[model samples]
Target: MDIHTLDLNFLTDEAIASFVVESSDGPVLVETGPHSTLKNLERGLSDLGYGLEDIKHVLLTHIHFDHAGAAWALAQKGAKVYVHPFGYKHLLAPSKLYNSAKRIYGDQMERLWGLMEGIAEENLISVEDGTEIIVGDATFIGWHTPGHASHHIAWQLGDLVFAGDVAGCKIKQGPVVPPCPPPDINIEDWHASIDRILGLKPSRILLTHFGEVSEVETHFNELKEILQDWAAWMKVPFEQGRDPRDVTPEFQAYANGQLKAKGLSEKEVARYDAANPAWMSVAGLMRYWKKKLGA
Candidate 1:
């Protein structure tokens, strides 16, 4: 099984994806970056001696624009796109997804995501937990891993697990950061998902934010700690009657300080900042807290 990392130069650098298990039958493209970086994705595939036509199955960790936006393009090439069942309808008709994103991104939506057209129903496939999908010679086991989003899935191929945001965001030199995106960020569920992935005992974890991480135990431990920290910090502001908007900057500052304490150099810290922005997680964390407390 061949795994290729396609670095989709989104707004920031290092927002890469892993195209794993490529063979004559066809290559499985995981995480299609954003619609704006389709050219970069195509170039990456071409560099590997394949094209959109060679991708028979596109496995999405989640349906976030940055991760699964270009899957629509691949679907046009007759590739079967597989995503979580909860996210299936949204992909078929991205109006709600686009409108929700527009609320957060506003004017930057087009610039950041380009155009996200709906994927044809015929080319769309949905899988729940414990569902095994065979694409060519490779077999991927899907686990309904939520926490990052209610519609997230973590695919296991052989001893390697394609952990989307379930493992959190770990960039070089920075501490493992949790991406608790809004609408469905459950702290308890996130912790359970981590345990579920760990139980699989995969040899390597292919993180969507960057490359492969072999330090499975240490990596999971770090992610668990950071997730708790972020959740705990976000809860305090809410309990103290602080505005969500005001708490965002505080969370950013706290996260930056934590990164600095982890001994990330200026250059390494810059990469972390570029790869995973603190505001995005802040919004998610705030949203999670609100839902948990019924605020």
Candidate 2:
């Protein structure tokens, strides 16, 4: 089996990535990116000598638009869509998910995500922890790893782990950055989830936000450290009773400084920000602290 990274080219180059695992049985796609990039995904599949219709299985880490938005489209074409059980309802009827994202993105929703159509129930496979998903001769073990999103799962195939966001985001020439999107960011759960990933002892991690990461132990260590730092940074603002918007600039500045110290150019910082917004991390971590304090 060979894994290929399909650059979704969302907003910028190398910002978002989806993986295509080529197997003798058929081609399997992991992460559909956003529906807006379906054309790019099709083109990528074509490059691999496969077509959209040739994709027999579609495995998703989560149902976030950027990750699994195109699963419905593929499912419509007879591809089976596998997702975390908690996310099954949303994919079955994505109105709530679509509407919720609309509130966040406003006018840019459709342009950014295209539109999320519902995946038929027959085509939807709700997976749980320890679920083994077999794609032809290839075998993938799905483990429920939350904190990024309750519906998140990290798929393990041989030595490779499709870590989704549990392993954090690492763009080229930058350090690992935690992706703390809102409504489901739990620091405790995230730590435990990271431990779960470490237990796997994977040689390579495939991130949906970007591409492959080979420094397994170092990557996990950095992700844990940054997760702590970001959470701690948000705790201060939360203790002062400051709104997330009020501290976003400060957090962004701090993060920018840290990234600069690591030798990332301004353009690289901007590209990283484009893939994973700093503001969302602030809000998500603030919410996590509030929940921890029983507020």
Candidate 3:
């Protein structure tokens, strides 16, 4: 019933995080950052007097590189990975996903993601919404909370929820920002997912991008408002047929301005973008608007 946060130190300090749930059965890992940070994850586990081999269950919020890149590697060590059913195929044979990411990252692929391999099908446990997984004395329930990605799931245990990107990303004592990555961003679905999380009435939420959020209501309300505002702002650019690249700077400025007003230092603002790039939001929001227009 104890949770530990692992700062992956991905690209910047406190950018990406993984959670470890210590149970009587074994250690359960939630969100494996990227494969590039696997060594740091190992070090984190070691710090807790455990090792990678000690992990028995790996629960992923989704298969996005930042969240599940190290999942296959952990599975290789005999851990059973639990993920949304929609992502099972990709993990079973990740070549297509790798190629797709390579197309975007190109030269930075290896440095950003490390080695991504296909996980054995037998090692994967496809979970549905409302699925309950019991590990030792703890109970974890999976809620299919799509919006950030169709495969996204927020796991709940007691009054705590492991809300990956569905609850948005907020650095400690900083403004919360929605993680709108492209190719599958759905604003409507995201809104519903946010509502679903709220219905859970969780007292605390743990985010994969950073750490725990104790002010659950305020955090989620602000996240929903900001998410809608960003999407609404991008709608205009998309309607005018403005290139995403051209509008990215404007979006970045607006987001940075908000962070600055929140008393975040320049370095802290940089870490926010490093955690969830503003450009990806531009591209993602544009895609969402375009899809709505039937373009």
Cα RMSD (Å) per model? Answer: 1.4, 1.0, 1.0
Candidate 1, position 187, lDDT: 89
Clashes of each: 0, 0, 0
How much lDDT does each candidate structure score? 0.84, 0.89, 0.92
- Find the 10 residues in a row with the least total lDDT in model 2: 270-279
lDDT of 1 at 282: 74
Winner by lDDT:
3
Write down the TM-score of every candidate.
0.96, 0.98, 0.98
lDDT of 2 by residue, 161-277 (tens): 999989888887589999888888997888899899889989999988788888888988898898988888888889999878879989999988889999999999888778778
Candidate 1 lDDT trough over 10 residues, lowest sum: 11-20
lDDT (10s digit) by residue, model 1, range 1-295: 6777877766666666756578557788888888888888888888888888888789999999878988899999988999999999999999999899989889988888878889999999999798999877888999999889999999999899999989888875456888777878998998899999999999999888877899988998988988998898888877777777777767777888888888987777667766667777777887888888867
| TM-score, prediction 3 | 0.98
Clashing pairs in 3: none
lDDT (C-alpha) at residue 209 in model 1? 87
